[model samples]
Target: MTYSSGSLINQKKWILLFHFIIGAIIGVLLLHPLTTMVFWYEYKGLIEFPGNSPIEFLIQRLITEFKFELMPMSFVFALLGGIVGLLFGLYHIRLSGQKNLVRSLEHELAEELPLLIARGESEHLEFKSTYRWDVRQQRTNRALESIVIKTIAGFLNREGGTLLIGVEDNGNIIGIDSDFQTLKHKNRDGFERALMDTVKTSLGGNACALLHCRFHDIENKTICRVIVESAVEPVYYHEDSVARLMVRTGNSTRELDAREAHAYLSSRTTKSFSL
Candidate 1:
């Protein structure tokens, strides 16, 4: 969950260098025309030349100006560009770190998914029969989407967990075909969009960044696995203007009262609530 200082420093140096190079190139490209435009605007009526047309006169001036000022102006512009690049790089360092951490977690989870499913639902794992289909009613149930969001919010509010859709509580691979039937696209891409939209709507846009969803083919069936990372701050599930705090308690998700939520957040700063 934490990155070393050395790696962070190295990443920062590379990002800064990359941005500086890009910015310098942009500056060099813009310098000549920009300076030419300024010069034309400042001295357009004031200067006279021996060309037949204004365009020809401007071209002659541009060539003359380039010969005299290009090198010195390029250096000034490149330095200014580099300083701007450094500021942008510094501003995005934390975001870059978070993205790297998320990618690392996703890679690890992809490799360990089968083992995690076989181990059954635990404090960090839970399985659902379908994303939005109700097997009992044999119909598309929109209410189940709320359940999915609740589980995701629970993981975000705790030490994080993985939720496997298209699997039964007892570890059966049922596939998400029934759920797909309810979607307009009726494919994996559509399902992912729907899932993420639900998370974004209920848990806020930032919560979507902490989640990584992947699909697997096992026993000729497709399964969706959602790996959630512990949030840096408290995440609340909003429903009908009401925001509720949910957390993973053993193998189930539970809602907390205001007092309990306050205590939980207070203690979370000093220690993790992972069991």
Candidate 2:
């Protein structure tokens, strides 16, 4: 007779039965007499039964009738409940770990994006050409008005960088017409005044003095170039967000993240540390 595994599992019910019996024995021995004595003393009339009643008899009858002797069953249920709770806790831990990992990845990506773009642009053929111009063709200098404030704030916060207008990433010339230029746009001297004025208004006086701005001449035409120096201490443009340090990536400017900012300060500020 080949015994089925199912029947063997059924036979294994004794494992549970053994635990129930042991638990019942302990509970009865410890609890039944104590409970009866306490109830008899506390509520004599309420607990009145015929004559001298044996605690064991009442307990045994209660166990038999109500199946309360299945102490092992109660224990098994409690154990299973504990196991389930532990599993849930472990699952929550895993989920929290995953969330932290995702957050770290996002922060790292933000830091690397600008550097990657710059590297790609630098490697391009156009960027390698000898036709580098500071600020060549100025049609409207709309970009000057648009980004001047942001550029200055970034440069002040981190290490300063060049603001090139009308020059393509590959060193190509694209001129901006005078009509498109901002009403305040002027020559080098006048441009400096304008820049200082804006800086003073937005960033306070002496803040602009911490950095410098110079205009570059290209092909006998004038284009504005501004260079700001890193502050003695880290400067914040706004209340919360650190002003993003931006550098030329081909024709575009990309903002540097925290790591790049740290590196910039380290390399530029630590000039005395050269071995």
Candidate 3:
């Protein structure tokens, strides 16, 4: 989302040049004729022409005197048009930046999830069997939600990462049907809402903006992929009255105590995260 100074300057120069060219064309083709008509109407009785009809006379004079009389007026109109073009160009650049950000996100999702999963868990990747369902006990475990939130906070506090739910630690696709059954709506929509609610309540609303969730079907089973972006400021996991800073050290989420949290924050520079 950040651009180098040189890149920004280059973009500005190109935008200005493009707009200037367009403005000059409009000035010569449109503004010059409009101005000529206004002047002709104002001095219609005072001026005499060789042609019988007014329209014929105007056209004849335009063809004959264009270079000599209209050059200065065209320059003035072109300058005014250039100023208008610059304003529009600046607004266009701002709008294009936002559009590019959206396209970047779309490109990220368009990438093959299976290929990413094949990489297995790493510093930037983690996998969970379910959101709240306990495969071992064959029941919904509310405690598992806290673990998911903790993992998200860890990624936010660190360099950011992707968390795949409905996948085993070893990368097997189990699907989240078990977790969905526990929800009232029992679908991807319901599941995403629950996940976001948990994140907002435990990790804060701002953290929810840093996470992107999507569902994909792999081998007749649906899996949820949560992409986390590093937070600009430190993020902590809130559990009742306690707040703990969790970080991803390697493949696992680790909690940092007061001194450790301070040291981590001091050593780290803020990063920009966009949805």
Model 3 TM-score (2 dp): 0.60
Task: Residues 101-208, candidate 3: write the lDDT tens digits.
Answer: 887776666467889888999999999999999999999899999999999999998889999999998889999999999999899999999999999999899999
Superior candidate under TM-score, 2 versus 3: 3
Q: lDDT-based ranking, best first?
A: 3, 1, 2
Candidate 1, residues 164-253, lDDT tens digits: the string is: 999999898899989999999999999999999899899999999999888877778889999899998999999999999999999999
lDDT of 3: 0.86
Top of the candidates by lDDT: 3
Q: Show the colliding residue pairs in model 2.
A: 20-72, 137-175, 137-176, 138-176, 139-176, 139-177, 140-180, 140-181, 169-250, 169-251
Error of 3 at 63 (Å): 45
For every candidate structure, what is the RMSD over all alpha carbons to the true structure, in angstroms? Answer: 7.4, 23.9, 9.9
Instruction: Name the Cα RMSD for model 3.
Output: 9.9
TM-score of 1: 0.61
TM-score for all predictions?
0.61, 0.34, 0.60
Task: Indicate the worst ten consecutive residues by lDDT in candidate 3.
Answer: 266-275
Query: How many residue-pair clashes does candidate 2 contain?
Result: 10
Select the stronger candidate by lDDT from 2 and 3.
3
